[model samples]
Target: MKLHIVPARTGFQWVKLGAKTFFRQPLAMGGLFFMFMAAVSVLSLIPLLGTLISLALVPAATLGLMAASREAEQGRFPMPTLLVTAFRSGPANTRSILVLGAMYAAALMLVFGVGALLAPDVPAIEMPEGEVSPERVRAMFNNPGLWVALVLYVPVLMAFWHAPALVHWYGVSPFKSLFFSLMACWANKGAMLLYSLGWMAVIMMAGVVMNLLAVLLGGAALLNIVLYPMVLLLAAMFHTSIWFTVRDSFVTQEDRAA
Candidate 1:
């Protein structure tokens, strides 16, 4: 595959195309996403190593979702088996993807460790007598360590973003896949930025609409009832968009020859 530069407007196109494609087979697409989450959750139940294993499976999982998206884009119903596309590609591709996953997991853990060191310890806030305060919940997320971890995560994210596809489709080595992924991201930073912002806007609008619904429908109970399903839909749509990003960012040999 050859790298291709996309205009910033292509980012918005990705979002729209993703949503449109997802709607075309909402049940199948949404089911695949849910299945992926279920698989991850089940893996997370394993033991002390469960979390690490789940993290390591992330790149593969992402690739599987993108594969599903590819199917949906082509007007085919993506089967549940598509979820394992990465592992089924071939022994070499599977090995490369696993190596990429391990690298991602390690990089993330190291970043988290450094972030923890950089952030000051947060004292626990004890609430009175069986009370659940929003302030306390918000405080947990207001940690500097979390922000630091998030900031450090960007490059790790970049490195793995397209690495799985590169490995599966091109037989690229693990290290080279990471390099190409990073360079592609840097090269297409404008499109990537707009793509990210578009998703952010979509999510923010969802939240606003959800809040309005809660107000009209009468409470947090209704909000909670709607929130989980909405989250799954949004997540599915986001994964659907990822395939477009990869598609636009790279060209096949035939396209190059043309």
Candidate 2:
């Protein structure tokens, strides 16, 4: 596959195309995403190692969703089995993806470690044996540790943004995928800037709408009932956007059609 230097406006089109793909097979797409979440949740049940494994599987999971999007874009229902495309594509592709996943998991753990180093031992949560008291929960948000994690995550995110797509679709090796992905992102800096700003605007609008709903409905508690599903839909759309990023940045339209 070849990299395409799309104009700045092309960035906005990813989310637009993503919305169109989502509407095309909402049920199938939603079901598959929820299944993915459930699978991750199940994996997370395995104790400390479970969380690591879940993070590692991220790239593979993302590619599976992209594969599903391809089917949805073609007017076909995305089957659950499509999730294994990365694993079964070819031996080299499978190995490369697995290596990428392992690298992701390692990078995440390193980020968490750095956060711990940057944060001071300020406070601890205490309450019932099973859960933190409500006050403690609020205190955690005010803790500096949270900001440390958030700050360190930005660059980690930038590095992996296109790595999975490169490995899965372009047959790049694990280390090379990271470099090429970063370079591709750097090359499309203007478009990515617009894309980021556009999403921020949408997020602001969503927050405004949610708050208005809470006010009209007389309680923030009940608003969550409506907001949760909306959040999930937005999350799905974001993944769809990632798929389109891969398409627009790597494949020509005519090639994508074939």
Candidate 3:
């Protein structure tokens, strides 16, 4: 049973690919999720450790992408242990994963840097020896720099949108992957832009609903519990979509034969 790369024509195609990919290797996918959660939780506890842990996430994620690509190519749906086994197999793949991860880290830093630059230089709120006014808080929200930051962050988000798939599955170097991924952004600009915007919109809407629920339910923790899995699932779907795109465009017949 040769794995065929299907053309993605609509949102349903992406969703189906995502769901099918997970269903084919539930145990492995589940294990990956658990490992990711455990790592995130542990990193969150240590001061400044979160940044270090964040660096690993891209590589780990790229590892998952590689695992999926290998499984798909072989037409075999192995269990979760396969992921661990694959990682232990060689140093070359590990290096590729780390390189891909570093690309993501660089993108994250760029995004943060842009945001920092665009953020307004507002003085810290001081207790003017009297009660604070609501108008002051409202004024903060209306800052032009804040709006610019929000607008500029969109492209940064889109830049590395398919990066994991590019490095993990395509076996491209970081520089090449970055080049092609950016080409992907421009070539499929409409679909890629819409995809990012659509996801962002969904996230924003979900955040609003969750925040409202949190206010009514008495805390955001419960909302987070529900949201975390949803976010992960979406992330998986996004990565899978990127895989489909890259596989169809860049992966050669010889590579698949190997």
Candidate 4:
């Protein structure tokens, strides 16, 4: 497969395509997303190995969502089994995906560890009257560890962005997939940045609209009731867009054959 650089504007197009495609099969896409979350949640409830296993399954789960997105884009109903696409591909590919997952988990742990070591200790906040003050909230946001973690996650995101698809479609090994994924993201960083910013704007707009409704409806409880599902839907839409990023950024041999 060959990496292709996309124009920055293509990021906005990806957002549009993802939202449009999601509407075409809202129930199926949304249900699959729910199933995805359920599976992760259940796995995470296990013992000590739970978190590790869940983290290890991330690449495969991500691949499944991408596959579902592809199916939905083609006007097909995506099955829950699509979530297992990575594991079912073949022994070699499955093992590679598993390795990729392990690598991702390890990378995340390392980043978290370093961030924790570098972060200053936050003083405990006193919650008088059983309510957190705005200062407490601000202190939470001001924690350097949180910022460090977010910053460190960027490279991990770049490395894994397309690694599963690369392995699935091109039979790239786990390490090579990470390298290629990183290169592809770096080569198309402008588009990626725009894509990220576009999503943030979409989410912010959603929050604003939801907040307005909460004001009209007269409660924070109503906001919570509506916001949870909306957040899930937006998350599903974002994951759905990931497939488009791969489609536009890479050229497989079959693409040339066509």
**Model 2 local distance difference test score:** 0.82
Residue-level lDDT of model 2, residues 1-258, one tens digit each, is: 667788988778776888889899888788778777888999999998999889988998889889999899888989988787889887889889889999999999988887777666766655656454777766677768678888777667777888887887777788988887777788888888888887777778888988898898877676767787888887787776787777777765568688
Ranking by TM-score: 4, 1, 2, 3
What is candidate 1's CA lDDT for residue 69?
92
Candidate 3 residues 204-223, lDDT tens each? 87778888888888685777
TM-score of 2: 0.86
Better of 2 and 4 by lDDT: 4
Badly placed stretches (over 4 Å) of model 3 are: 1-12, 23-31, 69-78, 81-89, 121-159, 197-240, 254-258
* lDDT of each residue in 21-85, candidate 1, tens digit only: 99999999899989878987888888858878888888888899899999999999999899889
Better of 1 and 2 by TM-score: 1
Which has the better lDDT: candidate 1, or candidate 2?
1
- lDDT to native, each model: 0.90, 0.82, 0.59, 0.89
Rank the candidate models, highest lDDT first: 1, 4, 2, 3
The candidate maximizing TM-score is 4
Which residue pairs overlap in candidate 3's backbone?
Answer: 28-80
Candidate 3 TM-score, C-alpha based = 0.63
Comparison by lDDT, 3 against 4, better one: 4
Error of 1 at 166 (Å): 0.3
